[model samples]
Target: MQSISSQTSKPEWLSSNLLLQPFLWAMSWLDYILAPLQNLIGYKRMAYFFVLPNLLIFGIFILIPMLLNFYYGFTGGDSILLENRPVVGAANFEKIFSCQDFFKPNTCAEDLFWRGAWNTLTFVVFQVAFIILMSLITALALNRDVRGRGFFRAIFFYPVLLSPVVVALIWKWILQYQNGLLNAFLVSLGLTKVPWLLDANWAQFWVIAVSVWAQMGFFTLILLAGLQGIPKEMYEAASMDGANKWRSFWNVTLPLLMPTMTVVLVLALIRAVQVFDQVFVLTNGGPGTATLYIVQYIYRTAFEFRNYGMAAAASLVLAVVLLILTIGQLLFQRRQEAA
Candidate 1:
């Protein structure tokens, strides 16, 4: 195939005005500015400039904060903050590991924060797994040929699009003690109020359940797109080999869905680690720090306690952990791809 060359291509105005007017030396500088602008905005990717202002804003707001966070991680004092800092040289890192406040705490003389770590891990593993599975199932169901499919899919994905605060507030109202909608309904049905958010176990359950409800819809939509792109003939071929629905799904569907699953897994992992807003709104790491995630702790450390340096150090450590986990997943994915 003969390819068109992008180089040596001059606009009609430039070719006519510059070439024919050989005596116009003063106008040459005009070409320097106008030529590039014309090429950029004339007809090729001109809309990209619309994002230029956003890009600048993001650089100032997000990028600058990120850079400052990284810089603060290495420094000893809380340079940008005022509290519990006096240039103590890697003392924070040592404290992060050794301190009884987090990663290890002695509430019952048995380490309460370590217990909280287990609680966080349980939430991460079970909540993420349940949400992913539910989402995948919803996606598969929606991808099928059915009546009112669009309506059903939209209903499922609507909760995900809502702001976290709004969703949390809604859940809060529903899951509140005796006056809550959920408890009221249950009590009306001859059941006692369930204390959904007050009890420790109930709080964890509601947090996970609410999180899954919000999360499943979006992942379903994503996985549904991946599912719809798959050729139907592949499933038919597997069926011809006497494969059942389960076998076809496992053998044909799942293997082809690896790329989508990989994306879902990594995104879920990242979100799981950074779970804060829902936990904050729903549990406030409460009933006694039962729902406190690593992020929630960091948030308290930085803003609540004003321990910015330690918080920065914790944030840096988290970034490193997430990076390593992402890289590890990518390596595994590459191996699967190769195989």
Candidate 2:
């Protein structure tokens, strides 16, 4: 018994790790620091104190940058310094909007900007649709009782863990013109080598497809959580009432999942609008600017063209569009809750 117990017990160093002692001692000071503040604020209000650090970080990073961007939009100059920039009023915005025909980008003073805008619109519509549809399908499949279900879930989610740049690079190697795996496979099957990234339409298609493949996993996990939250008893009840599987899913599961679906939809929309990294690494807005998105346009305007004011104006426009979408989502969620 003594030998067995000795074998099962953790080693002394493992049981009380010396490496953690300093960290633990430092963390213990939090009690001294927070106790006085908690007493002054009262226990109920102490929640704010715990949350203060996050609010400070947000203010320092996100909120401040956004306010600065907004200010920079009204100023114009080649200089990056705000003081050197002259207040240009609405000239930057006017430049962006100075198109004769709204439908024709060639009529615009900033034709590239218009092109990027139209490309972004197309990307958002297609990417969001695919992401939502694929995510829901994968979530439903994973929620079922099947062999190796855990492995399948992990396989689907593994792509989400990869960096966007890394994902793009991997796909770039696979889609290369000369020695790409995809091209080789096509040749083996008696098909000619196709220019996946060099062409306009193919580049657009692949960027959207690759983005959908990378991000679908995260939304799938959200949907899976929603699916699991639904009570099994509802299915049982429906079964007793002679309802088919399709009927039970259509009536019960769909309604319960709508809230989660709305959250996923809005998140996907916002993410789709801000897409840049993967597409940048994959296409670099090449093939005659076919895949040049709004974010890329802003980036080039600020850095490449040295047009800080125009970049800031474009940034503000993008922010306004996102804000509208977010507001719409909130209102929809409010109505959903009310009903």
Residue 94, candidate 1: Cα error in Å is: 0.5
Maximum-lDDT candidate = 2
Residue-level lDDT of model 2, residues 1-339, one tens digit each, is 889978896767766768678878888888899789878989999888878899999999999988999778999998999889999899999999999997789999999889999999999999999999999999999999989988999999999999989999999999999999999999999999999999999999999999999999999999999999999999999899999999998988999999999999999999999999999999999888999999999999999999999999999999999999999999999999999
- lDDT per model, in order? 0.79, 0.94
Tens-place lDDT per residue, model 1, 257-293, is: 9888888888888888788897787778888877877
TM-score for predicted model 2 compared with the true structure: 0.88
Query: Model 1: what TM-score?
Result: 0.77
